[model samples]
Target: MGEVTGEVIVITSGKGGVGKTTTTANIGTGLAKLGKRVVLVDTDIGLRNLDVVLGLENRIVYNVVDVVEGTCKLKQALIKDKRAEGLCLLPAAQTRDKSAVTPEQMAEVAKELKAEFDYVIMDSPAGIEQGFKNAIAGADRGIIVTTPEMSAVRDADRIIGLLEANEMQDLKLVVNRIRSDMVERGDMMSAEDVVEVLGINLIGVVPDDEKIVIATNNGEPLAGDESLAGQAYINICHRILGEDVPYLDLRKKKGFLAKLFGKN
Candidate 1:
């Protein structure tokens, strides 16, 4: 109920197809569900997809570039979410590349948003390019998302190094698309393994569920749903809020996540 002075957190994955944008949407939605004023900023530039994932693609009259380029006000560019109160999205410019916005501009925008919101979540694009730098420019903290793959973990480590080099050391890790069956069968890396390899604080482990794909297709984030993935995202949000929510025990049988968190 008090004035919401937000913390800017960047959700990034150095490699593509690692669920970074999904993480941003779900985290923003989860915080809003918990009654926090949240803004999801898509810094992906040319390949903007956060708007689509949050079901706000049709409502984007202006984008982050527009706001930065002085073509529109920041308030005018923000597309409010219909499903969650106090939640809005500052979409990326699909027509422009990452070079369209500078890191200074992003930092300025983040500062302005932080003064107005409880949480400002930025979705960084794939690769350690100008887009990635722009995304993390004004972040108070960083969430590095990676799957249970060696390549993903490697890229995550590289991103961590970059963040540390820039003096942003408050970083956490989220291992996504984890398959319990594969881990049990020794076919895939466990979340613990990924965390160990990355050598960072493990915030959450999201199970690989078809529900995530369905939710994305429906332009709905799974963070507030009843699915395992949804619970995982909620747990991540709680952790981000400095809560001590326990991680889901995915080492059980195939349906263990469902049984523990209730039916999907």
Candidate 2:
């Protein structure tokens, strides 16, 4: 209508160790690669990894708490990415706990960021406590990341309910760390199955790629990868921007010889 405002989307998963930070870094990088001004906020106060994933760990002189506490200005706290022209990061304070800043503080920070960037992506801490509330305080949309495992899926379902209960309308799901081989073996749940159980729109599906681990170890993001999972994350970014980019095919490939041998 009157020039749509920027969207604040939180990349969250209720359960920990389900690739929530990975999704945030990749999506933020993908959005920036699309020539959109993007700012990634790490709201996982006690345990922060977004900075490491984005390779901005060494560059973080000030953090979100510094800005919120008036020790530094917002501009000072923002760590500009060297690779992505329009990408910046507001890392969390490792020394501070989740209660250091309130949800209102997080919302205020996101509001200021939305005025400057096309997208403000928040990396929320796991659980349904104050940290989780702070992460989504300023978000207009939510992207829940989960693996195919029962534990992650169960946590994701709870997260969706909490988001809805908090009056956050726009909700999307991203099933991460999916193994096509497992699905082919009838051992893993399909993307459609996860969506049906959660009852939300599927934004994308990321495979359990070894390249992602390598990238993370190298202080890089999978979004810059040419791998299958990388392509999927990139497509998810396009969808966030209202593009109709289709999802990538993550089906496991079978060897011709194996097929001829009737290998299952």
Candidate 3:
């Protein structure tokens, strides 16, 4: 509604398959649901999927590389989300690699998008390479998404170091795909364990839910939905907006946990 000078936030994971793109889609949609203008930039060039996750892949006539290379206007490359009113997507060029756009060019794009939207969320590619660099180039803040695994936590720590080295200190963490039963059985790490290892402020913890797979397959973000994972993302949005929302209790029901892990 009101004019907003957007804040560019990069959603990154040093390791792939940790739901970084999913987090971007949901957070952008969540912000839109909160009446904020949100744009999701897919910076994972050559392997772009944010558009797919948001179901805007078919509508993408131009890509972020086009905007950087002057092949199209910034607005022309942005595909609007059909479900969320104020949500848009600046998809990456599928045919081109990360080298197609430099960090400076990505920063310029972020600037242009921020001038119009309330929040510009960039979905960074996996690994600490040029794509990751470009993703964080225009970001005012960063959120690292990881699963409750040692490998994911290790990568997240590396990402945090890189982000802080870039002088972007406002970082947050989201632990995804948390299986409470596994944690109860000591078969998997807990969200608290991941946080203690990464040493960052935890923004949200998403339980392992089949609904996430369904939503991804359906090209819909479950941010505002009633599912546990969806509510977790909504809580993340509220925390991003400076609300002191408490984290979700991801512990399984007593009966379910007892049945699955033989715990009381």
TM-scores for all predictions = 0.94, 0.94, 0.94
lDDT of 2 by residue, 133-190 (tens): 9999999999999999899999999999989998999999999888888887889998
Residue 133, candidate 2: Cα error in Å is 0.5
lDDT of each: 0.92, 0.90, 0.92
Poorest 10 consecutive residues of model 2 by lDDT? Answer: 1-10
- RMSD (CA, angstroms), candidate 3: 2.6
lDDT comparison, 2 vs 3, better candidate? 3
Model 3 residue pairs with clashes: none
Off by over 4 Å in 1: 1-4, 251-264
lDDT of 1 by residue, 55-117 (tens): 888998999999998999999999889899989999999999999999999999999999999
lDDT of 3 by residue, 1-264 (tens): 246588999999899999999999999999999989999999999998998889887888999999999999988988888789999999999999999999999999999899999899999999999999999999999999999888888899899999999999899999999998899899998888888888898999999899999998999999989998889999999999999998888875568656888855
Candidate 2 shows a clash count of 0
TM-score of candidate 3 against the unseen true structure: 0.94
